[model samples]
Target chain A: AQTVTQSQPEMSVQEAETVTLSCTYDTSESDYYLFWYKQPPSRQMILVIRQEAYKQQNATENRFSVNFQKAAKSFSLKISDSQLGDAAMYFCAYPSITQGGSEKLVFGKGTKLTVNP
Target chain B: GAGVSQSPSNKVTEKGKDVELRCDPISGHTALYWYRQSLGQGLEFLIYFQGNSAPDKSGLPSDRFSAERTGGSVSTLTIQRTQQEDSAVYLCASSLGVLGEETQYFGPGTRLLVL
Candidate 1:
């Protein structure tokens, strides 16, 4: 079984500042995918970034990036130049990718992020 | 191109009653997924459908929960004898195919309340 953990239940950051959300997972599989999803007030989940287990280099998407430490099973999200729009519930997830394509994502309890003006 | 969409954006039913939620995936998408999000909690996988493959119901919490996809396009999640604890937002997502790195686009979700 695979599980993801987000230690922080809630977080807040001032506008223009940077924030980091921590995530850790337990997986016996050597290959997989990790993702950070953002659910805004509209409740539509938006993918923030993704990291491949085999990639030693972390993933970065503009102001959003991940600090992926495979050895530690740690994948954290860093938000730079935080804006009010960034306020949302962020979730860390690991999806099981089977050869048959019958895969499901395991998600951690979310962290509610508040961006202060 | 439209993204995934779920019908009956909000559903209210009494305990012990049955409820059905529908999801319409993006055209040409061969993979569909169902997930439940409790209040202030993260998503819990429910079921998955891909092409002609057998659906994965491993994540279903109980026998009362079941899901079916028609023609690999639209899916329905049915809950028999609903419980108040079943109250949550039911989300639907779809992907182009089963590629390991394909992104799953999500819908706004159907808010189900079992009173």
Candidate 2:
């Protein structure tokens, strides 16, 4: 079974500052997908960014980026120019691709990010 | 709707009672998924459905849980003889296809409370 871990339960960043949330996972599969999802008070899970294990180049989406280290089993999310709108519960996910061409995601305990004004 | 939707937004039921949660996916999506999120915890996969194919129940925690997708556009997760431990937010997601790299769009989720 694959497991994802988010060591930080909560994190805070001042407005205009930057913050990084850490995540790690254990998987024997060489090819898979990693994603970072943001859930706000609205309880909607939004995709923040994603990284493919076969790609060494990190994935970036405007202010949101990811540092993916496949060898170390680490995938961290970096949020730049943090704003109050960025405050949310961030989760790291790994989806297992099965032989039948169907798969499901396995998520880590989330890290609540607070953006302070 | 432009995105996935679930209802009732909040449901409270007594232990041993049966509960059914619904999910409506975006039009044209070929794959749908169900997940359970406990308080202050991450999302756990429950089931997966793809275009008239057999559903995946591998992630279901117990026999009490079952889900089905109708017409491949809407899904319902039913918990028979629900238990207190079943309290959690049930989420639904849909993607254009069942490919591993496809991006999934999520619903707001249904908050289920089994008392």
Candidate 3:
């Protein structure tokens, strides 16, 4: 069983500043996928970004980038130029490629990010 | 209609009552999934449906939770004789099923509150 662990329960970042949410996972398979999902007060799980295990290059989307260290089994999300809208519950997730190929995202206990304005 | 949408946004029922939550996937999306979120439970994988194939019930918490995807577009998740522990936000998501590109688009979840 693969499990994602987010050590930070809550993070505080000033608006226009930067913040990084930490996440780690345990997986025996080397060819899986990892993801970061953001759930705001509206309760919608939005896909922040994703990284494939086989890829060595990190994935970045606009102001969001991931620090994926496959050897260390670490996947952390970094948000630059944070805004007030960035306040939300950020979750780290793992997705298995096998088992019928379902996108069953195993999420970690979220980190409540507070963007101080 | 533009994205995944779930109905009965807020459902409140008694402990022994049954409740049904519906999910309308994106048009033509071949994969649909159900997950539950609670304080300590985090994200609980309930089930997954791909096309018209047999559904995966391995992630279901117990026998009381069942789901069905009709015509591969819409799905209904039912919890019978619900318990207090079953109270959580139920989330549904769908993807294009492009194999390696498994980008899942989620819906605004249905918050289920069992008294």
Candidate 4:
């Protein structure tokens, strides 16, 4: 079984500033996928960014980027130019690729990020 | 035209009563999933469905919690003899395929409360 850990239970970032949410995982599989999702007060789970384990280059989407250290089993999400809309519960998920087309996502406890003005 | 959708934005039922939650996945999507989120439990995967294959109900907490996908399009999760512990936000998601490697699109979720 795969386990994802988000050490920071809560984080606060000044609007327009940068913030980093920490995440670590335990897995023996060489190939897998990592993702960051945001759940706002609206309770909508929004996909933020993703990183493929086999790829050395980290993944970035607009203002969001990941620092993926495969050996360390660390995949941290960095949010730059943060906005008020970014205030929400952020979760780190791990989904492994298997033989078939089926995949199940495992999520961490999540960190509540607050964008302070 | 796109994105997963769930019904009964909110539901309240008495303890011991049965309740049903619905999910409508994106058209042509071959994968659908069910998850529950509560204050005590962050996010838990309950089941996964693909095409006409049998669903992976391994995540279901108990026999009272069961889900079925009809025609591989829509799905319904029924809770028999609901309990207060079952109160939580039930979320539905879908993806292009059933592969665990694919990105999943989530619905807003249905908040269920057992009184």
lDDT, residue A61, candidate 4: 94
Clashing pairs in 3: none
Alpha-carbon RMSD of each model: 1.9, 1.7, 1.7, 2.0
Off by over 4 Å in 2: A97-101
**What's the count of clashing pairs in each model shown?**
0, 0, 0, 4
Q: Give the Å error, residue B74, model 1.
A: 0.9
**How big is the positional error of residue A55 in model 3, measured in Å on the Cα after superposition?**
1.9
lDDT per residue for candidate 4 within A90-112, as digits (tens), equals 99998843324346788899999
Ranking by lDDT: 2, 1, 3, 4
Which of the CAPRI classes, incorrect, acceptable, medium or high, describes model 2?
medium
lDDT of 2 by residue, B6-93 (tens): 9999999999999999999999998999999999899988888989999988778999999999887889999999999999999999
Write one digit per residue (lDDT tens) for candidate 3, span B23-90.
99999999898989987446888899999999988788889999999898999999999999998999
Model 3 residue B95 lDDT score: 92
* Residue pairs clashing, model 1: none
Better of 1 and 2 by lDDT: 2
What tens digits encode model 2's per-residue C-alpha lDDT throughout A14-109? 999999999999999898889999999999999999898899899999999999999999999999999999999999998875434568888899
lDDT per prediction? 0.91, 0.91, 0.90, 0.89
Q: Name the runs in model 3 displaced over 4 angstroms.
A: A97-103, B98-100
